[model samples]
Target: MALLEVDHLSVTYTPRDQPANRAVHDVSFHLSEGEFVGLLGESGCGKSTLGNAVLRLLSPPAHITGGRVAFDGVDLTEADDEQLRKLRWVDLSTVFQSSMNSLNPVIRVQAQFADTFAAHKVPGDVTERATELLELVALDRRVLRAYPHELSGGMKQRVALALALALRPKLVLLDEPTTGLDVVVQRGILTRLAELRRELGFAVLFISHDLGTVLEMADRVMVMYGGEIVEDRPAAEMLREPRHPYTRGLLGSYADPRLPDVRVSYIPGRPPDLSRTHAGCLFTTRCPHAEDPCRTIHPDLLPDRGGLVRCLVAQENRLPVVTLGSAEAATVLGSHFPATGSLDRPADAADAAPVLTVERVSKRYTSRRGMRTNTVEAVRDASFALRPGRVTALVGQSGSGKSTLARLVTGVERPSSGEVRFTGEGGADVRVDRLRGRALRDYRRHVQMVFQDPFSALNPTRTIAYALSRPLANFAGLRGAAARERTAQLLESVGLSPAGQFLDKLPHQLSGGQRQRVVTARALAPEPRVLIADEPISMLDVSIRAEILELLGDLVRERRLAMLYITHDLLSARLLADEVLVLNQGTLVERGATREVIGSARDDYTRLLLDSIPNPFGKAAGQQTLPST
Candidate 1:
């Protein structure tokens, strides 16, 4: 028997007045012993709901409506509250999206483990288990006594994972476990998770928005849309040839560094409505190959090749590559230059006026541990400038303080000591540090920021309408109807389709990518002169990251918005940036043109980072001794 089998599982959530909201609809899949399966979709397509349903964590107003969820032949769907409580952590464990917040802040980490053990009537040497698990996650045992605040984001996630494995359950469900972490940290955690799976011999249901990570970790993959599994296949076979038009669009939508940037496209619209009753293919509205049949008939999951597809057109028509010819690049890439969008729009010339200038800006913070205060310098005299309509990227290792620089630039925190001069504000120049109150707010209006995780950045309670309107009302003085129409325009501009549906849905209702799109729309609503995107795509999959980047790039060129692209990724910098600044240990190591920096590196630390980027093209990491500049 399979370790876990979810047959035709359906979950629904309902508000007081509205109809039942189907989060998962007739999704069926099974995992064998020690096997791995990935549930892939955009943010709102019900992957997490499926994970929650399997774990029996779906709260009031949301419940399993249909089908059987069997774990090792015991019906989990029918399992009562007490049965679920006993089964969880001991028999089936789940690492939730917000697992970092799972720990009790008042209780010590070791005590938390002790509670779990005591409840289970298992051996209570919690320290040993905690130490072993910490070692497994590459964390020091000293963290056992520390609270969650003491741990870094990556460290907290590791601790959460260790707790999930404390019982060594037969099944482990991971929901976007590596969502907000940087690439290096993400890779490390995934490797550890893979090791845990092998060591414990547990079945995995890994849910992620990033297709690349899913393809890397999963044995089999399923593409979900509007609460249904639209496609299913072996991860490799699916990546090789996805049959569903929605699946094809999803695969093509995001730019994976492993693949070349060309031949990429996006789904023209947002996902389907879960609350509205529909008798069609869930993805028909956004699908390019949708026919009359698609809108009228609901397709069933039937055998295709290696797995299954749930679209009549997909069953009949072979999937297309959805290649972008020269015209596609012209409308997008040409905006970077003068000829495509506007004639006098200006190319990235050396003579362009510099907007925001940073000269030797560095920040440091001291940690007090028993009176021995160790000063940790975050930024090391990092210097760069945003030119007319060009992108300047900050590339570095995790703690090198790309975020610190962003905070400094946006006046979130004053730098420890350094100069940041504004040169070409049409004679409206002001030092970033000295700018106070009104000046700071004015400066902020000129510069907007986009965060990594699309979901959390947005307010879950508010509709997208409210979110996109806040900036316009606060920054631009537009309110009421003015704000609403402007919100629609901003939504369309950011590529969230229809714009009508998004205005009503809450943040949790959207997918990770779409929530991010709404965030971008909010940032753009203020009509800022500078857009500071901090690791914007680090939380996204390979497929969707490029789409968001392209959106930003398009805005930069077409709207002439100066962009500060801050990230730890060298490859993304190469693709999106005109200039790149390399930071190491809170210090600026090098700055040059993107092509120049990537091609000829004079500094060892810069080269280390450039080399660190996984060569998606599969080239050997070059060995050229770089000097400490």
Candidate 2:
């Protein structure tokens, strides 16, 4: 018997003010014993809703309207509350999308495990079982005594995985388990899960927006769009010859780091609104190959070659190649997008003048725990100069002093021993630490920062207008109608058109892309000469990323602003930066023109970082493929 099966599943949400939203429309799939299946799609495509429906965890305004979910010959939809209570952890379990924050902060790791055991009524020594599970996930036993905050992000996720597998369930549902994690840590977690599945023989239903990781980890892949499954096939076959246009578009969204200088493309239009019904295909608006019938007839999943696809054009073998050409993408990126060949090397600019300069700066932190005192060097004699109309990228892994350096430059913290100096067009150089009163205020006005995680950076309760106007009122001394006029202009500059529409809306009302744009607009409100953006696009979706990068590059060139782009992804650094500075363990290891440093690196650490990026394309020669479960 199949381990899990869903036949004609459907879900809908009925909000009080708005019309009913049909999230999942007649979605159907199955997972066999010991099989690893991947569910791939973009955000708001009902991937998480389907997963939640299968687990019977959907809360109101959302509910499963119709479906038959059978697990091991038992219909879960018809199961009683008592039966569900017994079946939950014993036969089925789930690891959620944000499992890193799932643990209770007040409890120790082992105590949380004990609670799980008590609820499930599992018979065993709780402490020993916890230790064994930790070992299975490649974590040390010491983590059992620590709180959730004490553990790193990856460690917390591993703990969640261990907890889910505590009862040795027959099947596991994993939803976006590795999203937002570093590539190296993501690979490690997936590898560990694969090993455990092989040893324990449990089926898996993995849901993610990350296609590259899915291609590497899953045996079979299913593509979802507008709450419906569009294509289903073996992982290799799907990547090699994807029939559905939606599938191909997703594949093109990610750029393979192995193929340096490659241009990636994304679907342009927004997803369909679920509250309003569609007559034809849900993806027709963004489909490059969309035609006559696609506008009037809704396609159904039918056999095409060896797999099943829902596109009429695919069944007739008329779909064009989805891989976009460089010139085509460039035109789509618009003529105004900065070209690599058009700009001079930032370090060699003829009119270069230092906006901010750091000279032999170092910072150290001293911490005392119990009876031991330890001193850690965050930055070790790092020196660099920021020139106007230039972008210099500081590339490093986490804990390599990237954030520390940013704080030093932003005046959040002073260096322990060295000097940070700033010079204007004709003004004498001013030491940062010596500034006070009006001098300090003036310096802050000229220097501003755009932070990572735009969602957290903005106040959720405040309107967008309030957030943007604060800096203008405090620094530029504009208020009331004057401040409002400038706010609208700032919003327009960042590509958020019709500023009046967004001014009154709260931060939560806007999309991720729009929220980041508002954050960028807020930073630009003070007319700062220097902007420090730290991993600004890391949390955004693939399609929205290029737009934000283009916006930043345009602002830098048009305003003659000095930009410090801090990131761990070398691909992005190469795309936006003219100069690259490589840092490792608080020390500057390499610095040169962007192309030279990326193409021919002398440092082994830099090479390792470049190589660690996940290749979304097919496997390279001598690459180790994960063994199928």
Candidate 3:
């Protein structure tokens, strides 16, 4: 018998004075006892809605319009409040996307555990139970004394997981559990979760947008699209032969850095708006092999290759085999670069001089608590050069000083020792740290930065035109009609076409990918010689991530701009960077060509980063389990 089952589930959100948005449409699935079922999809595809609806956790504005959520033979949709209260936490629980926000900020971890036990009237010693829970997640008991704010992101996530499993629930629903965590930390959390699942024998409904992670940890994978389940199959089979095009696209978007050749592509176009009704296939607009019937006839989920797939082409066994590096993929990606080839520097790039140089730079911070002063080194004697038309990737885990190094290079913070030099007019070496007022402004004109979070980087109240035009006017000395024209061109360069349409739209009006393009456009408005992209695509969807990477690569090649690509994602580093530098605790651990370093890493830290990457292909694809650190 199944542990959980959803029959024809549908969820809708109807805001006051707004049309009903059907977020989850006729979704159905089943989870067996101890089974790890992954729900995969892009953002806004109803993965979370389905998970919440299953547990009857949806609040106002969202309601389960129709469905039967059967958990352990109990119909959750028909259950009363009292019945739900008795079942929740004891039979089922959840770990939300943001662990920090999920936890009470003012409450100590110990108190939070006590509250759960007290509310449930569970007969047990709170301290002893809490200690046992913490140990299960590999966290120390001392964490019980700390508040939510005192713990790190990974620790908070683990705490949330511990809370979810406190009562030894039969099933747990985890939504994007490791989304924002660093690779190593994410791997540790997942490994620990897998170990606990084995020991406790609890079923999991893991909902996430990350295809690689889902494929790595899931026993069975269900791909969601357009508020519906498009594919449901075993993880290994789905990885080997995905029947649905959307599933294939998601898989193709991930590239293994350890491979000799790495290529990644994305599906074109955005997801359909759920508020509006659709007649045909929701993915038709983005589907490469979309046909006539696909435009008007909606497909139903039918058995295909031992799994359910919602596609006419797959039903007819007529789906084309399009490789990631094929022409069809290139057309779908809209990429200007070659489908498969060496990401070598252009022939003319060899003789270009260094645009920026860091000479044994170091950064330190001193914080005083009461009468005691403590000093910490954020970066130590780091040396590198950014040459024109070349991308120098700085790869490291969080708190490894990657961002601090970016700040030091862009003159945000002065180095405690040594110097940062930029090539100025007439071949002069300008000392970045020594620059003042006007000189500082001039230096900023040559060096521009694209921040990590596009949503936060952009101004909420300002229009796209204002964001781009201000930079143009200030740095390029352009005004009036000239600034407007320049802004349009900037948008076009970043691939946000029909610039007039986006010009008047606010940041919130654009999709994450569009907002990032606008951010990139604003960065290029200054016509900077050097571009520092600090985890620019970390917050974007997998498909959009490929687009941003391709855009950055195109800009570097065409404009001969030197780029510093700082990120924890080694696969992206492999895809875009010509050279790679590994950082460990602010220290330079390894440096070499991208392929050589990632494929045959020397440093333990570098290898650890590579190992942390989720391998969808599993053991057959040479993926080894991440070692315990």
Candidate 4:
């Protein structure tokens, strides 16, 4: 029997005056006992909505208008609040995307677990149970007393996982559990999660935008798009042969950073409009295999003799050609990985004339925890120079001072150390470090920074039109229609279709990838000579990752923007870098041409780093998956 089952489940969200927004529809699926199920899709594609519906956490305006939800033999659709409360922690739980927000910042970590146990009335020593749970996630026992703020993002996420498993629930719903974390942290978490499942024997409904991680952990996989389950199958089999066109489109959207650059096809149209009824295949607008019949008729999701397919093309082919694109992509990358492209040559004296340079920059902050005066060296003795029309990657693990270096270079923070120099495009020697007051403002105009999280970076209260226009109005002094027109042009350039579709929407309304594109477009508003992207693609999925990477590459070649690509992902750094700088413990350990550093990795740390990169092929390829934060 299935551990949990949902039949014809559809969820709708509507404001009092607004049209009904269907978050998920006809999302029928079942999780068998001890099976690991993955719900994979792009952001804003109902992945999170499905996770929320499973937990009955849909807020106001969201109602389960149709469907039946069964946990084992009991129907949850009619369960009372008291019944839900009883089942929640003991039989069902969730580990959210943002663990920082998931935990109560004011409460101690141990106390939160105590609350979980108390709510469930599971009858256990709360501290001991919490400790056991913490051990399961590889967290230390001492973390029990620490407040949410004291822990790192990874630490906090693991703590959240521990709390979710405090009562050893039969089913755990995980939503993008490792989205923002670096490599090492993600592997640690996924490993522990696997071990926990083995020991506890609980089924999981894993939700993520990352296909790689999902393939790594899940027993079964479900693909969702436009409020529906387009495909579902066993993890190993589906990864080997994805039959649905929508699934193929999802996979084909971008080149894997770990692999080489090849011709990638982007989904041409936006997802179907759910407010209006979709009588045809929901993905027909973007499907390359789409024929005349698709738009006129809807597809049913059902189990077939070949496998689970939800498309007419899928029924025709029976088994998809799992294109050995990556192998070809890998072979191309192997050929390209060692050779300097048309842009980047080996670092020599000729390449030393820097476009933007920072020498011995430092930033310090005082400890907030009453250590009686200890300083945090956010950026210490950090020095790197970005060459003209070439990507220089500044890479280090988290807390190794990458973002602080960005803040210092962007002039958002004053340096505590030496100097910054910029050779102006029009050929002026500008000492960025010595610039004071208004001079610093001029320096800021020449160099721009693109942040990682687009939502927090943008002014949420402002519309996309206003936010994009602000940069133009301030930098170029364009007002009214001119600014609006320029904003539309920029949006169109960044791959947001038509531009008008997004202009009036707020930051929250756009998906993560679209929001990121807006951030890039805003940075380009002033047409700055140098662009410093701080872990820009780290938060994105592999599909959208290629888009952003390609965009940056095109921007560098077309606009001659000096690119500073800061990231923790090695393959990304290698693929995007002209010259690579490996930073460890706030010191430059390896610095040279991209090919040189990657092919003949010099430092042990650099070698260790190269060793840690997660391979999409599988662990059998001898690649390590990063720790899940």
lDDT of all the models against the reference? Answer: 0.75, 0.82, 0.86, 0.76
Candidate 3 on 356-416: residue-level lDDT in tens?
A: 9999989999999999999999998999999888899999999999999998888878999
Ranking by TM-score: 3, 2, 4, 1
Q: What is candidate 2's lDDT per residue for 157-201, written digit by digit as tens?
A: 999999999999999999999877765667678889999999998
Clashing pairs in 3: none
Better of 2 and 3 by lDDT: 3
TM-scores vs. true structure, each candidate: 0.84, 0.91, 0.94, 0.89
Lowest summed lDDT window (length 10), candidate 3: 333-342
The better-scoring model by TM-score among 2 and 4 is 2
Error of 2 at 41 (Å): 1.9
Q: At residue 26, give the lDDT of candidate 3.
A: 93
Better of 2 and 3 by TM-score: 3
RMSD score of candidate 2 (Å): 3.5
Runs with alpha carbons beyond 4 Å of true place in candidate 1: 253-263, 320-347, 367-371, 424-429, 437-442, 451-528, 537-545, 569-572, 596-629
Q: Once model 3 is optimally superposed onto the true structure by TM-score, how far is the C-alpha of residue 311 displaced, in angstroms? A: 0.3
- Candidate 4: Cα lDDT at 93: 85
Q: Tens digit of lDDT per residue, candidate 1, span 424-537?
A: 356777887888998888788878999877868987888889888888988989999988999999999988879898899998877767888899888888788788998888
**Which ten residues in a row are the worst by lDDT in model 4?**
333-342
lDDT of model 3, residue 274 = 93
